[model samples]
Target: MPALPRPAAGPGSRYTARASTTRPRPARHTDVAALSRHLTTRDLWLARMLHEHRVLTTHQVASLAYTSLRSAQRRLRTLHQHAVLDSFRPLTQTGSAPEHYTLGPAGAAVLAAHAGCDLADLGWRPSHTGRIAYSPSLGHDLGVNELLARLAARSRTTPEAGLPVWLSERSCARRWGDIVRPDAYAHWRDGDQTLPFFLEYDTGSQPLSRVEAKLAGYAAFTTATSTRPALLVHTRTASRDQALRRRLAAPARELSLNIATSSADFTTSSPWGPWWSPLGPGDTRRTTLTSLAARWTPLGSAADLEPTDADTALTLPVPPLPPTPDAGT
Candidate 1:
């Protein structure tokens, strides 16, 4: 027989596959029944979080779930050993990079079983971890997760503050891709105040004009859905923050979009603090996220977060924070 032509090289060629550095999958078998024997409620929740967010770092997972980094690392390593979670450490220019985690095959099985659905319903593939490990948007995804994880972590100490609903980019896109695709959508509750906002985690990679243009979609989404959630544009640097504020001010006002801008520097202390600067002439003072609800009283009538009939049953929203642990686990 004539020699078969070498497999055509394209997107899935060996050359492209070499980019990922994820640890090898465990050779040992992992099944849902076996997992049930030892997996705790927190482990299941972490699997759901990894499934929803795509990826999270060791530090981010620690902030969101564990009491300390040591505990988080220990449990995470256990999960990794059992193949409930897969991890990869990326090469860094200086110090080492934290191990970034994604849902493994066993995790997807557990999630699907818990949700009363098939593996296909989970929308995960064998290539999921490798894809995320080598994705170009890995840094951006981590940044978004870091900010939200901080908000979730804050609830641990501040009993009055909580993030009830946090939807990842995929979830947001499913709901509003036709109108506007926000980086994430969340409901921030502080005492008696609740603010629902769409986040735009800017990394200073795109032109300011392109960033400003996103307001048009938000404006349309508001009109189409008759809901007016706040739009928060968080930039990597203060200079980018100011530039975005200036560039977006006119259009935001023109569209009557409730928009705000903040930088990483200001948010390092506490994102829930007075770090957000609204767009408008002479509106220079930063304000808290809860206060923004007061600033735009109309948000009271804009609480339309409930899933609609059009949403796929598989894509229902998940609580940002895991369920509170029982008295003893």
Candidate 2:
């Protein structure tokens, strides 16, 4: 075997050898920076992208991180090894082979802990795909699911209600025709008149322009019906301020709408139920005092509220009760 040359030593290297002459060699300590150096900016960006999208493939994360797919894959493995991420799975896209990558629970927890950090703040922008849903069925179901449930319940209650509960109805336009599906429609005979009601339930975060368009549809349908009422019930996860309340309630009231909006009355049971009735706005006060008293009453103490002769003397005259299910607006 050929002899190999040894490394030349410098003055600094001699200090370690002369142990008594110099300070005893300190014990090797962990390099904190080295421990975290594997986590590059690309890895962080990938994690943030997954957090925003709620799901991502290796290719997708790579594209966001501005790195090669393989580099992105290696980074994910490192992250998994460091307990920063859990694991990944295969996801198939049309016209492409299966791609495997996803943020594990650990990854999600980290991302969520710092969710307020925005890519826009970091000078990054994602392409606007304008994709409605991953699947056509999903979009259809999301748009029509709750409406269908209400209709199904109505059908079970009144099988002969003559409600047209179609999934897809086509509409014609000059340039582009669209499939328009009104969520539910029911018709009933009222004093020799066939009355119809069109129902729509919107539950997603939607644009104001889209909201106006839906309102326009409801207006048109209501105008076309024999003697029907158009009902729109929109539930949202976000808070609706009083300004929004006034804006939403104004049109319905002006147009003689039976519209109702859920307000911030979280104390009442069925917090999201019909809190206000636009049709009977005056009747709102009827139950206010009674509701408060009922809430304060102890359980199993219905007998405790027996009115005395003095209580009858102090009673104020209440308005006559309206027959039928009044909105008590």
Candidate 2, which ten residues in sequence have the lowest lDDT sum?
313-322
User: What TM-score does candidate 2 reach?
Assistant: 0.31
Per-candidate TM equals: 0.88, 0.31
Error of 2 at 196 (Å): 4.0
Candidate 2 ranges beyond 4 A from true positions: 1-133, 136-140, 154-181, 187-195, 224-226, 238-244, 261-281, 284-329
Q: Evaluate model 1: give its TM-score.
A: 0.88
Candidate 1: what lDDT?
0.78
- CA lDDT of every candidate: 0.78, 0.34
lDDT for 62 in candidate 2 is: 47
Candidate 2 residue 121 Cα shift, in angstroms, is: 50
What is the Cα-based lDDT of residue 164 in candidate 2? 32
Best by lDDT: 1
Clashing pairs in 2: 284-329
Question: In model 1, how large is the Cα lDDT of residue 26?
Answer: 43
